[model samples]
Target: MAMNLPSQRGRGRKAPMADINVTPLVDVMLVLLIIFMVTAPLLTAGVPVNLPDSLAKPLDQDQKPVQLSIDDQGRLFLENEEVAETDLPQRLERITAIQAGGTPPQVFLRADRQLDYGRVMAVMGELNRAGLNRVALVTVEGTPK
Candidate 1:
């Protein structure tokens, strides 16, 4: 029986080469995809309102309308930024003043389902008194459960 010795090893053997393994990259990409899928729905802007649905198609405005949210606590938010009730009129005036020369700026009200109807109406009235008549209610698109 003949035994191979280390000194008799072939010199034709090549050393292992270094390269980036893409398996980890693929795994990270898949994880990122899953994270986005889970969070995308939560990124939408709106008060938690069980909006009344209608068969009518959604309306598209020429310019981005101002967003006003009324939460269950009766707090008012202008474009996701909390606004003092007293400052609302002044803010609306300023916003409308900027667009005075152009088309009247529209106001979209997103009131929580649990909010008082009177509170929502008062906000609309304030906007109207501030000379912003192009107002619309924001609602989801589905039948009430």
Candidate 2:
């Protein structure tokens, strides 16, 4: 008697895959790109001010200085902290005293366009009295005449 046998389709069937799907990765990357494009302009430093124009070139330094601002109301701020004018010299002196190996901290001054020049000069004088000589005036670039 002859026996009937079933035929095998191919040599052997492939094993089930164990790799992860990557469709979600492409979607996440596109979302991140769009978020960065929308938020890039909002991360700039310095508050918007109508700075006085000057013909002088911007001062260049190795390290960025600590920013100090004087508003139109004659209010003083050190990095956004409200500080009394009388306390400025003491604060600056303390900062300089903490310097390692006698390296003085650079101080940059920003005065409002409508602020009195006398107030600005007084602040400069106080910084000078504190032995902090590395100071520069901050200004906005003007349009070409």
Model 2 CA RMSD to the hidden true structure, in angstroms = 7.2
What C-alpha lDDT, on a 0 to 100 scale, does residue 81 get in candidate 2?
79
Which candidate gets the maximum lDDT versus the true structure? 1
Worst ten in a row by lDDT for model 1: 3-12
Expressed as tens digits, the lDDT of each residue in 1-145 for candidate 1 is: 9964444355656445578899999999999999999999997785565556655568987888888888888888898889999999999999989988987788888888887788989999999999999988987777755
Model 2 is weakest, by summed lDDT over 10 consecutive residues, at 4-13
Return the clash pairs for model 2, or none: none
| Model 2 ranges off by over 4 Å | 1-27, 33-48
CA lDDT of each prediction against the hidden true structure:
0.84, 0.79
